[model samples]
Target: MQRPNVVLIMTDQQRWDTLGCYGNEVIQTPNLDWLASEGTVFDSAYSPSPSCIPARACLLTGMDPWNTGILGMGRGGERHMGIGFEHTLPGELAKAGYHTQGVGKMHFYPQRSLNGFHHTVLDESGREEDPRFTSDYKQWFERNKTGEYGMTDHGIGWNSWMARPYHAPEFLHPTNWTVNESLKFLKQRDPSKPFFLKTSFARPHSPYDALPYFFELYMQKNLPKAQVGEWAAMHDVPKDASSTDAWRGVRSDEDIRQARAGYYGSINHIDHQIGRLLSYLKGSGLMNNTVVIFTSDHGDMLGDHHLWRKTYAYEGSAHIPLIVKLPKSMGRTVERTDAPVLLQDIMPTVMEAVGLDIPQTVDGKSVIGAMKGRSAEARDFIHGEHSTCYSEEQEMQYVTDGRVKYIWFPRIGTEQLFDLSSDPYELTDLAQRPEHREQLAAWRQRLISVLEPRSAGMTDGDRLVSQAGKPFVKSPHYAERLARFPLPF
Candidate 1:
């Protein structure tokens, strides 16, 4: 039998509930919904880390962030370590005689120019210091740095210029150039051999850039607002919960509603682009022989718990959309056994789909049997970790059995236990409650038992050294700031 082509479509900062199929009526994601119907949708998929780089590193390598050493944001630290192009999915696929290519944002740093893919089309532009990309907007403030004229800063204002131009589609944004490039590659690639193509869309991420049509679509609807009363009560949340500057100020009911509407608009915009890509694949005669997997790196906090970005352990940030479409065996979409799964499973699953050997170095298990409707043992628990961003301040670990979630924040000496079955929103913390102490301790012991063995030489604060023998540059600003505001851990 011939190997099936692999088309992995990933979006950045996309939440699990954004699709029409995921019980969301506000946003229209027809393509994603159709894909879900045609494939097995893992309702509860999660990223090991909520951040972009770390989560992506975990995706490509099938290893946890600690093992891969991609602990923080773009272009620093263990990134320089020799883990480059060698261990990536493209690298592995290339060895298996597949043509590998990537388009759009992979966030593999050194400007996405490295990596072993046969082709790379990077569409990211703008000054590196853009505030929309980081927490400190002031650091990127430069009067001379200008782009297509848009809004400017509004001093201490809640609903100001920052919120205008509410919707921009992924393709029209600078990153869209990468998508166009991918289209070109798809149109021109060799048709004889199987290919591994990753088309990533970077939108709904920040600056909330999208075309006017998407903006107009949401403008017609009255969006929902953040529940401020519910949010303020969450102040005791561990500081490292998904870091974002968007939720800093106290917002009125109307402001939160508009913000959520804008976020939905961004999601819809990406959905349209995905629809276009899927249509192209079908029209080009590539749909029948291809295995398509659609998912996201992590999720955004779009006012969930009043948080605006990833890094939190909440379902809004941890749970993601995972849909896999294999070539129909008898014109049927097989439903796999209901079980917990992790993003790490992707690498081996792809290998299995292509009949390749699962590498010992990869930590994920093959889900090909499950995808094919064959019964198989499923993962009992999924593990997730998030360390200090920019700075090594807060460290967190999570283990979940799909029904209960256990989180440990070592730096702050805080723990969170959520009975997902009862409280999916994670509004209440049961870690300190005496009645739940036994369950919490059991979860902690399981977390430690799983982690300690995997971490042979790993340390909480150890820097990952590159293959070239250079150490990762921990963000200088973050280190300095940590020294200033020492949290009581």
Candidate 2:
């Protein structure tokens, strides 16, 4: 049989429970829901770093954060620093005679770094860090010549909690443009070669501005309220209630409602665009020969536990949705597994599915076995961490195996444990409970063993050490890459 076409569809900072397949009833994600129904869902997927740059680095290289050379959000000026990888997902596939193309937000430095794709049509969300950077979406928006409304004309800051209807028309929305470009690629792709295309969306991260119709769709519905943990009083009080972009603070009911409305609306809108893409694939008779995977770089906190943004070890930030739809020729049945999977697994999974060799440099194992219900033990657990992003106290190292999660705050030397099976929202902290002491200690030791091998001074081989928090530090490999491919800025 011919190698199946690969299409990776990703959304930025989306939560695991935001789709109907994940028990989100209020949101209209029929397209994704159908995909999940017919495919296999990894119910306990996570982002290793729980932020954009680092998580995406893992996806591209199929390596953990330590190997990816990105710890947290890059360093001070390193946010735009380029990453060097000897083997990339698209690059490896391209070598196997697949036509590789990427559309939408790559979030790469110099903005246009293709990494491995044969071609890319970018939309970096109006980010012009590089002087020569101009996204194809931005260029199209300009050339179409409609009105004075710019992409940010909605007046929403990129990472703000502010919510509103997109001031521009629906056709001009970046989500629409992303799908349109993907459909165009499908239409004109090389007929003789299998294709690997990544279609990424920038919304559901922030600037929570959906089209007016979608905004109204959820505004009229009763959205779920944000759940705060019993031990989360430290973040319940607003450090800056007046700031629209505050990362941690108590938000009013109306504020949280509006944000959820816009957020849910944006997800629903993206789902509709996905429907459009799926429709095209079916009409073109390419659906049966294609492998479709859906996931996100990371998840948004979305006011959960009074936290507003990402980079935390909490489920709201780290947990993500992972669904894989194999082609009809594979004859796979609908399946769901609670195995702990990460973004890095995608690269090897795609490689295995297309009959390519998994690169030696990759740290992630292929999940094709899990997709076929052949492997239930993907990993014992997942260790995730992030350097200080919003505050020193927020720096965390966590371990989870889907049923429970243990988080360690190095700056404060505090620990929190949650039983995710019973309390998926993490409403209670079990770290201090007497009966759960052994469980907590076991999870803590799991993290300690994982960190002991690193030179980041996180562990002393015997126990975790507390320290004053500092800005993120780049790994040696990352530093070398930045030096070789120094940013023009």
Candidate 3:
């Protein structure tokens, strides 16, 4: 059997329920919906650490947060630690004779670390922390500026929830550029070798600036209102509500609609670009021998539970969409699996698809068996966490098995339970109810056992300990990676 070319398309901060296939009827995602119809959708996929750097680290190394040395956001999560990873997805695949190329936001530190891809074209928006850093997308924008306004001229903060139409022409949007570059790569790739192309997009995360047509397309529809839970009243009081980038707080009905409109528009724009990529693949006769997977790093909270961004264990932030389309020659029909999976699984799954060795160092399991309609060894549950980020009370640890979830806030010792089978939006908290105490206690024990072996002392074999005020702890591997940085003169 010949190895298949692999394409991994990922988005930033995109939620699970934004696609038409996910029961979101108002959104326009025909391309993704078509792909889902022809592929297997992992219904319960999640980010093990629901943040940018940590989640990408898991995808890169096929390791969970503890093994990847990235437990949480780590106060901006911009630490230069690419040197810490001894094995990466592209690096391992490259060794197995695949020509790897990455296009779009990698979010890896050192700004331009290839992590073993033969080449990479980046779009690291506005992150010029490396003094001499500039993205390929920005460089192209500078040369092709149609007017005086730059990409950021929309005046939306990079992480802001503000919504509006993009100020520039639709062709100049970064989302369009990302797919254009990928198409160019497909046209010019080394045809002699199988290719591993990771096309990552950096939108639907914030500064929700979509093309004017797309922005209005959603605005005219009756979008679903943000669902706030009964237990979220404490956070409903406007804290930093005046800021465009407020992480927590309630917003007016009009404000939430504008934000959702922009967000849905951005996703629709990406979906249309993906349609272009799919068309090219079909036209070029590559569809039969290519393995294409689509997913996101994590999900945006999107005002759910009065939370505006990620790091929460709620379904809005932790759950992500995962669609895997196997080569047409494989003879597999469209399927949906309820098995709980994580972002790390992508590594071994891709390895299995291309007949490469699944590196022994990786903690992620391959889901190929399940994808093929066979009973694969499945996990009972997945544990996820993030250190203090937007606020001290935001530090959370959660365990879920698709049907239910339990979140524990270490900073305030608060617990939340949701029966996902009945309430997927998590509108009600069951942690305090007497009828659900037994279930909550069982879930709590599961979390305790997960944290007991960690070096952070988050749990003491018998119970979860409070971790308030203490500084964020870095895994030894991450600390060593950060230590390798050269000192300033």
Report the lDDT tens digits of candidate 1 across residue range 1-489: 568889998887888878887778778899989988888887668888777777887788776666666555533333322233336677788887788888777664444344668876653423232233421111222322344332222121221213345322333353344456667778888776689999887666665544566666776776644433232354434453323344333445555555556567767867777787889889988888888998898887666565566776678778888888888742465653456677778988888777777777687776666665655567778888775543332346688977899976544556678888887777677887899988988887767766654443222322211112223323243344235543222
TM-scores of all models?
A: 0.80, 0.96, 0.97
User: Clashes in model 3: which pairs?
Assistant: none
The 10-residue segment with the lowest total lDDT in model 3:
75-84
Model 2 lDDT per residue over 171-290, tens place: 988999999999999989998999998999998889999899999999999999998998878986555556888888888889999999999999999999999999998898888889
Worst 10 residues of 2 by lDDT: 74-83
Question: Model 2 lDDT vs. the true structure?
Answer: 0.87
Off by over 4 Å in 2: 74-78, 469-474, 483-489
lDDT of 3 by residue, 1-489 (tens): 558999999999999999998889899899999999989988899989888888999999898887877777756233444555778999988998888999999987777777778899999887875668899999999899888888799899988888999998778899999999999999999889888999999898888999999999989999999988988887775656778888888888888899999999999999999999999988988888999999999998888888887987889999999999998787774489888999999999998888888888799988887787675578899888887777778888899999999999987888999999999999999999999999999999999988877757778787888877766655666666567643231
Q: Which RMSD does model 2 reach against the true structure?
A: 1.7
